[model samples]
Target: MKTSRLVIGILSIVLAVIVLFQSCAVGIGNALQANEEVSGSAGLMVAVILLVAGIIGIVTRNGGKGPFVAGAFYALGGILGLTNAGSYGDLILWSVVCFLFAAVFIIGNLIKKKS
Candidate 1:
C-alpha cells in the first residue's frame, strides 16, 4: 500500500510535468497563431491540480486518509480537464490517467478496509 502510493505519487508528478509542458507549448502556439482551438489556461489549471494530488500522495505514504484526499484531487482535476479538453487529445489522455489513478487510490483504500 505504501509502495503503491509512492509509485502513484511519482507517476502523477511526472504526469503533471508533462501536462504543464504540453499546455504551455499549446498556449504559446495558440498565442502566436491567434487561435482558440484549445484552452491552455484550463490545461494549466488541471496540471496544478494533478501536481497537488501527487504531493498529497507522497505525503500520505503513512497510509491514513491520504489516498482519499489525493483521489479527490485527482478526480477533480480529471473532470476539469475532460470538460475543457476540446481538441487536445493529450489532455484527454492525461485526464483519463488521473481519473484512473483516483479510482485506484479510492478503491484500494476501500478494499483494504473490507479486508
Candidate 2:
C-alpha cells in the first residue's frame, strides 16, 4: 500500500469515531451542534468516495497493510468534510481522531513490513 493511502485510512477511522461519539452524545445541544457541522453535498460525496476507496483497498490488496493505507485516504476525506463543512470546534476533535488512526496505520504498516 502507498504511504498516502495508509495515512488516509488511519484518518478515516478517527473521523468515524468522532462522528459516532458526537451523534451519540447525551445532550440535544451536542446533537444539534453536530447537525450544523454538516458541510455541503460535495463534502459528503467526497467522504463516500473515500469510504469506497478504502473498502476497495482492503478487499483487493494482498496484505493487511493495504487496507490500512486505503483507510487513511478515507480518513483524510472525512477530515476535509469536518474541516470544511463541519463545525470548527468539531474539526479539532475529529482531526485528533483521524490522527490516532493514522498513527495506528503507520505503526501497523511498520510492523507488517518488519515481519
Best by lDDT: 1
TM-score (all chains, Cα) for each model = 0.91, 0.44
Best by TM-score: 1
**Per-candidate local distance difference test:** 0.86, 0.51
lDDT of 2 by residue, 1-115 (tens): 4564545544554555445444344234435666643443324444454455545554534556565565466467556645564443554554454455455555656666788
Alpha-carbon RMSD to native, per candidate? 1.4, 7.2
Clashes of each: 0, 14
Give residue 14's error in model 2 in angstroms.
12
C-alpha-based local distance difference test score of model 2: 0.51
Give the range where candidate 2 is weakest over 10 consecutive residues by summed lDDT: 37-46
lDDT of 1 by residue, 1-115 (tens): 7798889999888988989999998788778888776657778988999899999989986667889999999999899988988756688888899899899889988888788
